[model samples]
Target chain A: MELEALSVGQYSFIQNAYSFGFAVMAAATLFFWLMKSEIAPAYRLAITITGLVTAVAAYHYLQIMLSWGAAVDVTSGEVISTGKPFNQAYRYVDWLLTVPLLLIELILVMRLSRQETIKRTTVLGGAAALMIVLGYPGEVSSAGGLRFVFWVLSMIPFVYIVYQLVVGLKESISQQPESVKNLINISVYLVIGSWLFYPIVYLFPLVGLEGGAAITAVEVGYTVADIVAKAVFGVFIFMIAMRKSQEIEGTASTVSKPAAAAENETSKPS
Target chain B: MELEALSVGQYSFIQNAYSFGFAVMAAATLFFWLMKSEIAPAYRLAITITGLVTAVAAYHYLQIMLSWGAAVDVTSGEVISTGKPFNQAYRYVDWLLTVPLLLIELILVMRLSRQETIKRTTVLGGAAALMIVLGYPGEVSSAGGLRFVFWVLSMIPFVYIVYQLVVGLKESISQQPESVKNLINISVYLVIGSWLFYPIVYLFPLVGLEGGAAITAVEVGYTVADIVAKAVFGVFIFMIAMRKSQEIEGTASTVSKPAAAAENETSKPS
Candidate 1:
């Protein structure tokens, strides 16, 4: 199965998949931004960042879909020979914008200290962006070895990201309210698990999938991963934020009582 | 464009879209079932039913995808004439099982009286299932007039469902805690809004869309609607359940003071 043998129908399918993903992401963005909630400021920022991540991805996916559609003859479902090539770079562009924000938002929702948040966000966010940038050459490369080389280069940052999330954040996560500790752990695992799909999709060509099947697998695979990473993960983020907000409120109500008692005694007969 | 002019690529796209939707639904089902939460039993049942809805839809969608994939000659991206006809019936089958569960779940989460639950679930669920059954004949009919007639028949039940959800549930929803009241309203609206898409998709052919375009529109449209109806709506259900659970706890602590005081009096030195 050579690249030239890829049908226009496959491209249409890919384009439509992207289009669907974009629509969902855009809707989620609106939801996270517009929905009423009494969550804390830190978590509110997390929600806003979640929306931004999806919005950016939605914009890029729209571009990717357009590029794919432009390359196909819609009526016949055939790839036009003379049309502009499908812009695969749009994915990398999306990742560059979203990957860092993904880490930053997660850190924000944790409501860690300013120093800790800054440290983790800088290290993890930078690594995430670097991972995407490193993966780009491989994504666009036709040569198998070049793709593999860039993939390996990209994995370094990915591994670092996993470490920062899993190991570096361990103590802080452990100190979170018991209700949301498990949720935070699950969110971390969700991020790590969904992300692993990208590398597998990247390596599909090496596994003997070529042309239409490979393209279909890659496109479908990425779309699935994108939904999980953006929409589903956003749901988890919102849940965590809600739980943490409740916890803060509960603590404030309990802790304010002693202070109120002391103020009553001081003011009563002085 | 005639239905026969529907291209292999279009079918491939539709099949893949269904597959993606199935994967997400299955994952969501598991999340609802397995995730740790402190929601009440009524709400927990709601969560379980949410899972069941998606799980059934996912299974049927898998069958639909397989039927579509079997019809396609993957290598050439062409639909084979002799292959098993794409199982449009699977959608109806799925709706029969899940649509009723969807209504029942919403009623259960509202924690209505047993009689009210039964009454609402029976009327709403029965209407929902009937709506799907009525629409199926229209979906399969070649004659435009027959399809239109069946579609009109289906809308009767749809209007009934809207009435029950919006009007019948009004008092019960109003009695819910303030935190969850808006959510219940939104959930009802979400259900009605997402459902309206199905009728629109059914009537697309009547509006001059035909062949590949109509098929594409219908499949993609239904896929989007399904995601919203099941997955996105489930998220709202979970949120409402969480808030209600918190409210229940809050009220229990505050309202139990009299009983505690009475017990203290009974146990005193007298």
Candidate 2:
């Protein structure tokens, strides 16, 4: 891309956008690095890396935006006429970065759940992965057919996630602590809400939105919500994992208390 | 907020945005409600009320978008400009709903911390409150001055929050659970990162972003990060809260266990 040749203003836009992207990537990377020793750090790492890569792509695009702003539009390759090449390049990078992250997160969730013997984790994780993969064609396609395919793929994960949540709730209803239940319920809503965003972004514009504005608005909105749901929600899930680990430790101590006390008494004089 | 006459497309764009907004609001409300007995139920009620209001306002904006799209752009304001006005109106409502919620969450944390006799909670909570109040001006003002004010104000909570976490680490240096420490650290980064976003968004555009596109991009990125931080981080807080409460209960049970056993032995016949 002609990033090196941009005007001062374009350079600033790119710099700012890139800086923002860098912050995201750096934070994600650092967070994962810190979490590496935990039970399921790979998923966290993948997610963070995705976030990091996305930030890098975003920064590049911001650079493009700065340069292209004076000449034409950011997406349609409008303003500078020369801007299309760079814009498309960045857009492709953005997609490539995000899609894999989504897949990795799903796989990680699946593996973790399987370890915990949660059957639904695999199904839901697979569905989420499938949805992401299927949606790609629609995402990259010009003709709405790719979108339709993507929507169907995406819906599977949404449904699976909701299903896993429902099952989790039912299982928890018997003996789960209120906090655990709350975590599960809230996490479900977050994931579901995120999944629902795709269709809303893709299909909602059919009514009255003209040209690229609707798409732009949808993209912007979804990106914001997605980031929030993934990162923030990911944190919550980690907390839950930790909480569960703690509970197991607590139970172990409780169960061993009597035996430990008897052994202590035996060592003392009668 | 001329929202009565919407074309299908404009209506859809506005509707989808509002839908996502409503989902977030609803999830937050549900979470607050679930934890009402622990925190203040009143706050949850307030959030619910605010969310409902946002939903209504969203509906109104959808109509406005529809009308704007359907009508020709009359520069003289001859034909009602539904687009910008409604969009601004929606943004205003969003600000009203969220800013208050942020403050409320901080207050709730302070109140709970006080009840638990955690000194840092009160101080940190107070700082957060002050920041939220300061952010109001920043939220409203489009000027660099206002933005700077809000930026500084917002930073205060982050600083306080970090202080609180660091102190927690210091207090429990030897005994602090790895999970708790990791969670706290993640939160510190997430919150601080979000706090830094406003300046970047405002300042970056001055260099090159002539149109609203770059500003919008920054806003979108900020919103995504912020939402993730708040809601997702909020979940971690919830998990921690639940864990803490459970720990409290466990301690209570352990403390009373021997006494109860002794009482039972004394009452039994020889």
Two-chain complex of model 1, DockQ on C-alpha atoms against the true structure: 0.05
Regions of candidate 1 where Cα sits further than 4 Å from its true position = A1-4, A7-9, A77-82, A254-270, B1-270
Query: In angstroms, how far off is A170's CA in candidate 1?
Result: 1.6
Per-residue CA lDDT of model 2 for A131-189, tens digit only, reads 56665666556566556766676676666556755664365333544435566556556
TM-score of chain A as modeled in candidate 2: 0.58
**Which numbered prediction scores highest in TM-score against the true structure?**
1
TM-score per candidate, chains pooled:
0.56, 0.42
| Per-candidate local distance difference test | 0.73, 0.44
CAPRI grade, predicted model 1: incorrect
Q: What is the lDDT of candidate 1?
A: 0.73
Model 2 lDDT per residue over B84-159, tens place = 2222322333333343344334333222212222244345546655655565555445576766766776776656
lDDT per residue as tens, model 1, B18-131:
988998888887777665255643256567667767776776677667656644454465454433245466667668667877887788677654346657888988899899
lDDT per residue, candidate 1, A1-270, as tens digits? 243456654554455466557655765675576431335565888999998998898898778866765554433333454456767788888899998998898898888999999898999899999999999988788889999999999999999899988998999999887767877898899899999999988898877777786878788789879888887788688878866664565455543322222222222221
